[model samples]
Every structure is written in C-alpha cells, then in structure tokens.
Target: MSAPMTPDAALARLRQYGERTSTWSTATYNDGTEKALHGIALTLAAELEQYRALELGTAEGRVSAKCERAEHPVWLRDLDDVRGCPWCELDRVRAELAALPTPPEPQIPTCISCGATGGPLRPTGDRYPSGAQQFVCSTSCTGVTS
Candidate 1:
C-alpha cells in the first residue's frame, strides 16, 4: 500500500510557507502546525494498526489498501476491530485465559516505616522502570515512601 504521507506532497505544501503565513501573523501554517501535530498523532495511530496487522500476517491486500486511504480515528478503529479479522486466531490463548478463574491474591507487604499498609504492588505490565517495584503511597498516589 501507499505511504501514510507522501514526502513530495509535504514538500509541495512547505513551498507555500511565506505565502500562506503572510496572510496573517499566524496563518494556516501556524494554526495548521498545531492541528498538524494532532493530525500526525492520529495518522501514526492508524499506521500502528496497519503495522500490527501486517506483522500478524493476516492483513489482506484490500485491507492494507484501505488502510492507505484511511485517516484519523476511523482507521484507528478499523485496525483495532477484530470482526472477521484475519488475525482473530491470535485471540485463542487470551480468550481462554480470560475465561479461567481468578488466582489467589498475593500477600501485601506492609511498610515498616510509618506503619503504613502496603498500598500496591507494581505488576510486570506496569509502565515502571525495569525491575522497579513501585509501592503505592500509603496516603496518596503522590506520596512516595523513602
């Protein structure tokens, strides 16, 4: 499929900078830049879906072509959708796990200092640093015990 944005189209648009900007102190280029930032974020989101689909080896030529034409949240949604999806087979393990019973909870370790109850245990899935165990604050989220 075609790229998300054509470099030539971007360069062509950039050639009109002063002409577009000269219309006002902040023209389409200025306001467009802020809007472009948000636009690009959405574009990247869509691309991520396509990339994932492509990686899973399930994305069809038609689907990949459609992804090339897609924009914003709609493409994002389609990419995330699993309806008649080529990669639905990837869900088997996850679906089985979700159907299983919950395991016994791990014991919460209390904080010796301040006699604080252990607030939380950081899971491996947490966005914490590698090998870092984040203890939830005894008082509040911002409260970190030294």
Candidate 2:
C-alpha cells in the first residue's frame, strides 16, 4: 500500500500543480486533470487548515498561512510571526510618501509687455519707465510696456 501524503508534500504538490496550470493553454489543457488537481488541492488545503487550527488551539491563533503580498506560504507559529498585512504595509508606505516635503516650484520670468507668465521669455532690448531691463514673451508680444 502507498504511504499517506504529508502536509509539506501536499503543499509542494499544490504549488507544482499551480505553476503548471498557470501556463496551460486551451489546446493542451485536460479537463479531467484540472478537475482532479482542483479536488486534490481543495482537500489538501482544508486538511492543512484543520491541522493548523488544531495545533494553534484557538480561533485568534488562526492567522493566515500565507503572505498575500508575496503570495507565499508563511509557516507561522503565532501572531507574533506575522510581519504585517499587505494593505497595512501599503498604507504605511503611502503615509511616509505623504509626509515627505514637496519641492518648491521654479520661478518663471514674467513678460513686461503682455504681463504673461511662463513659456519662453526674451529680452526686449529696451528699458521700462523705472529704468529696469524689460522682458517679453517670445511669441505674440507687443514689445516693452510704457
């Protein structure tokens, strides 16, 4: 008679089957094989969950057996073994990013003729009434203001 499959072996099998099924195409897919794999995976997962529940001895001790962010199994002994939830980690990163100081905007030279700001500014080669050098927009400017 064949030996029973261990939880570790079942997990490994599930991972192997998962990888294989992910790359399967319609042309090469087998319904029987897929169904069998699903049934086996579901049974193994349930058994594993039950095993963990029994081992932990409490509902509160029933933490996730896998890391959602990494999509990998986490052999946790207790709640302390949990690093953090994926959403919590993401929110923490967002908060840190939000806390960072935003850089100041660059000063744009103003056009003295049209009072326009931004875009290219060029010297009008003329002086304002206050003897200050005047600048104008490179396009559609009416020259220096009086």
Per-model TM-score on C-alpha atoms: 0.23, 0.29
Model 2 C-alpha lDDT versus the unseen true structure:
0.64
Residue 76 Cα positional deviation in candidate 1, in Å, after optimal superposition: 11
C-alpha lDDT of residue 16 in model 2 = 70
Q: Tens digit of lDDT per residue, candidate 2, span 1-146?
A: 99999868978777676557666555445647665766677677777777777655555664545545565434444666656555556778999998988644324456865766655778778864445656778878654443
What is candidate 1's CA lDDT for residue 76? 24
The best candidate in terms of TM-score: 2
Best by lDDT: 2
Judge candidate 1 against the unseen true structure and give its global Cα lDDT, from 0 to 1: 0.45
- The TM-score between candidate 2 and the true structure equals 0.29
Evaluated at residue 81, the lDDT of candidate 1 is 56
- Model 1 residue runs over 4 Å out of place are 1-19, 26-87, 106-146
